[model samples]
Target: MRTKPVSDEKSQRKRFLSGNGFVPFILRRLLTSVLLVFGVTFISFSITQLVPGDPVAANLGQSAYSDPKIVAAFKVQFGLDKPVPVQYVKYVSKLLHGDLGISLSSKRPVLDDLKEYFPATLEIALVAVFLALVVGLLLGIISAVTRDRLPDQIIRVFSLTGVSMPAFWTALTAFYLFFFVLGWAPGTGRLAPGADPPPTVTGLYTVDSLIAGDFSTFKQAVAYLLLPAIVLAIYAIGVLTRFTRASMLEILGNDYVRAARAKGLPEITVIRRHVLRPALLSIITVAGVAFSSLLAGSVLVENVFSWPGLGQYAYRAAVGLDLPGIMGVSMVVATVYITMNLIVDILYRVIDPQMRDAS
Candidate 1:
């Protein structure tokens, strides 16, 4: 066959990529995500407006709630004196400029506080999701392999109990047993008393500490992290286990699977190469959902452990009735969720060629 010219090949490649609608599909989703973020921001702002108490009061405290001049200045200072539409316009404008407004409680920028707090949540939530995937997949694989037997029965019941039980109750019980009685983990918070966080290189204590050669802080951070990560992971673990088991069962009985088995391939190789790899499509879907839940913040677990993550920060904002802070947290959460969803949608294209073809 004759070789195509370089310019012709480039033109053909561009045409092929543009013809698929793949790039356009992603761009469309991005546009949709931007619209969704706007909607979420509007809803969050409106809901915060519905919250009783003035932003001035939240900013100045009980002492200044009755001071007219102070309240007026505060309102103007943050543009709260305007009508709701005006305020929303200003808020969105500030957001476009990377300003999340000032935290009424701390008198700091909401964006600054979020940057400080979010990484902590991400660190622990990442650990939780990792643990969930590892443990859940192991149990699921074993259950599928030993289908209808005692192991499967036990795993089913365990998953049921986990899915049924509330995370708060589990967290409290675990805290009492592990921290109070056994004293295995740190009592509360992300660091030991009087211990400064290591240099904030990445704001994740474990990683930052390790990077700075601060093993002591790194170890303490891990210890403080483990209990909460475990508690937060329980629900995800149950869900992943069930999904994995179901998908594995479905895959195990396929004609190709049976043929592979009949070909006398090693059980491990067949399971790893043919069964697990393909069945992972379903697992990845479940994992993305689970990870979203984790990253959304385990409110109860964060509060119980006194972890200074987004969940704890949000809970404090709620209790304090800090409208700006509340709005900031809501926007952060919506952004995280939408971003994760976009990532998962893209992954669907990679995992299944049929999905790309259909798109």
Candidate 2:
């Protein structure tokens, strides 16, 4: 047959790969996520307002029956005397300007405190996530590949136990067993009591210490980080392992996998090349969603371990009914969740070309 010009063939292939329209699909999802974040923030703010006792009273360490004059003055100072609608408008406006308001308990700007603590939380969370992904995926693959074997049973049981245990309980247990009983690590806090916290560049002690060329501080921070990170990773490992196993099982049943087997490809190659890559798309999606929960859930673990992180800050703010602080934490979490979901959406396109075309 007469061959088409090279340019014409390339154009045909491009059209085929492009598939149908995608712009509207991507734009719509992005816009929806933005709206969801806004809605969540608004609801959280409204709920914070409805809780009994004025934030000023909470900060002032007074009962609800405090002097009317004192209460009035407190409200006025914090702008809480204004109508609810007015307050909401101000809050939304300030949020638009990236002003998270002042924390009543700390008497500092909420954003400033958040900036101070966020890096520690992010570091712990990142390390925990990395651990979870590596350990969970490996165990899951091994379990699936060695189905009906001892290793698979052990992994499944471990995942179940991890999922069933609460984070606080796990953290406390780990603290007692590892720190108190075995004397293997420090009991709590990000570093030893006498060790001076390195001067903050990023507020993450590990990174800041390394940047300052203080390896001792960095090592101590890492040692302190292990218990809490492991506690956080346990549940994540459970979730990811289940997801990976399910994805892998489905991928293994596909015709391409059978074809690879028929072609006498090694089992490892068939799995590593044909099965694992496809399975990971789902694993990555689950991991992203699970990561959002990790930060939010770390409050209990941080408290148990005495880690100086955003989770601890959030716990204090919530117990004290600090409106600015609670709102600040909520907004930060909402923003992170939205941002992560967006990144995952984009990554889906990269990992699965069909997703891009369908979009």
Candidate 3:
């Protein structure tokens, strides 16, 4: 009787896993994420170690580098005195306890620095991605509907330009044209000069200002965010426009879409109901990936604009040969990519009936 129950339980559990039981699905994903993070740590640590530079010398500078005792103490402090394998073992140990160690340049805990800088990156990335999605979708739908028309040709040219232009070059041009020539946009940073930041609730200036009912700061924050967000959105906009146009074109040629058109449906109605609805899945997947890329790829834009985000931090870390800082940034970026992909996968499974059934 006990053996029968055990076998029945085993079969039930197997069925649950096979059919996407919520708990088991989430647990399985969590396990995969943990393994991926583990692998990222090893890779990041190894790559950071391979970067040629004396972190101790860089941090201590010429004067301090002459002091043997100081250099030896510094090496011992950051585990540079130990062998590579030993250092990696210690790093993994500290990582398990949530210790990212101290930045050789900033002399602050890497995790703490990440916490401070990540919010800025997240804010810009969110705004940039939202802008990309809206503009890209509109342009894409217009281009598809007006295929071979003037508008389509113009949008295609614009998409090509956006795709080809480097972000730093675009940022400099935008900054110069708007801030200096036209004087339309504010300069860099999250807030304007002499403006006090709103209370720290979400660590995002715009969000926190809105929460604190500070309209003036919120407006200024948006103004400061606009140029950089636009710059960051350019590449993603190009990619999404191309993807959406392709997806829309494919959907518009489907039998149901032709049937709707043949049934005397309005062009707008046919495009919206028949074309866009089916193309949303692919658009969402691309958007999620683009958002993660924006988060990771904003270094140059952030540096050009003097935005105090993770990208800027990473730049400083690399320039100063801050191993812990570099490792921390790498891990955070890797986690963001993995997390975005996981979210997309979950959404795909939830939205597509075939995927859910097959799972």
Candidate 4:
């Protein structure tokens, strides 16, 4: 009787694991991300400290750098004169309180600045990722379905060109053709000159404008967003296309795919339910990596387009030797990267039953 009860309990536990056990997976990812964020903050802070320029001097500028008393007072005020450990403790403490420090350039809080600019970068990145996924997956599936044919050759060559093209060059070329010559895209900003932006709800013009029932503002935002979005997507689209094509080709030749075909399944149904589902593991991995990379790559894209975004802000901070600004941007980027990786890991667990079994 005891053995029977124990067996029933074990079965219940097993069922729970198979059903709701992903909670532990999510917790593990969150815990691991916390550690990574700490490490990023520590390492980035240390390296910025080691950089030759003095923050006090940078903030004070060339004139007051010669004034020892002024410099000393400035360092003390900013806690730069404190020991490294003390400074780190204070910095981390402020970070925990949602204080990202002050941007010496704009005389604004870094958190406030990020709140203002992050949405623009996010808008572009999200659009770029969407375009990449749609175009890339379509091309990849077409290439796989028509393997070794002219269409496959054309897609491979096109993707190769995209991978090889320099982002800066592409940005400049697109700007010239689309904005300057053709006048299709708006000139170098997130809004047309004198065109009013939507009310500052989420800082995302498209959604915020739509929420406010402002179709005119939404249309303008989309026009301004399209060029940079396409430019940012070019590289990611190439990578995802190649990865998806390779994965799909392999899956299309699998025994199950052949069996599905032999069982009189429609080719489309077989590819969709059998081949594509199995191949999504690779697609998800590529998309996650691509999204993270696009966040970093926004620096160049924003610069070229003069978009009022975090990338431009980060670049300005670096040029002015603003350590707080740099650290804030670095931390944000690191958080995004780690969070995306965690999402990808969770997805892998979902897509591959073997991962769940192993856990």
TM-score of each: 0.89, 0.89, 0.93, 0.92
- Candidate 1 stretches with Cα past 4 Å from truth are 1-28, 57-59, 356-359
Q: Give the TM-score of candidate 1.
A: 0.89
Best by TM-score: 3
* RMSD, one per candidate, in order: 3.7, 5.4, 2.7, 3.5
lDDT of 3 by residue, 284-351 (tens): 89988888889756998898888999999999999999999999998899999889888887877676
C-alpha lDDT score of every prediction, in listed order: 0.86, 0.86, 0.88, 0.88
The reply for model 4, stretches above 4 Å from the true place, is: 1-20, 357-359
Candidate 2 error regions (>4 Å): 1-33, 63-65
Which candidate model has the greater lDDT, 2 or 4?
A: 4
Per-residue lDDT for 171-260 in model 1, tens only?
Answer: 999999998899887888899888899998788999999999988888899998999999999999999899899999999989999999
Instruction: Kindly list the per-residue Cα lDDT of model 2 for residues 9-127, writing each as its tens digit.
Output: 77876654443445645666677887987898789988997888756656774564377887787778778889988988898888889888888789899999999888889988989
Clashes of each: 0, 1, 0, 0
Model 3 C-alpha RMSD to native: 2.7
TM-score attained by model 4: 0.92
Candidate 4 clash pair list: none
1-359 per-residue lDDT for model 4 (tens digits):
12234467778766544443678567766877999999999999999889898667667768788889988887776677889989899999999898987876677888988998899999999999999999999988998888899999999999888888888888999999998889998788998888888988888899999999999989999999999999999999998889889999999889989999999988899989999988999899888988899977789989999999989988998887888899999988998899889988888888888877763
The clash tally of candidate 2 reads 1
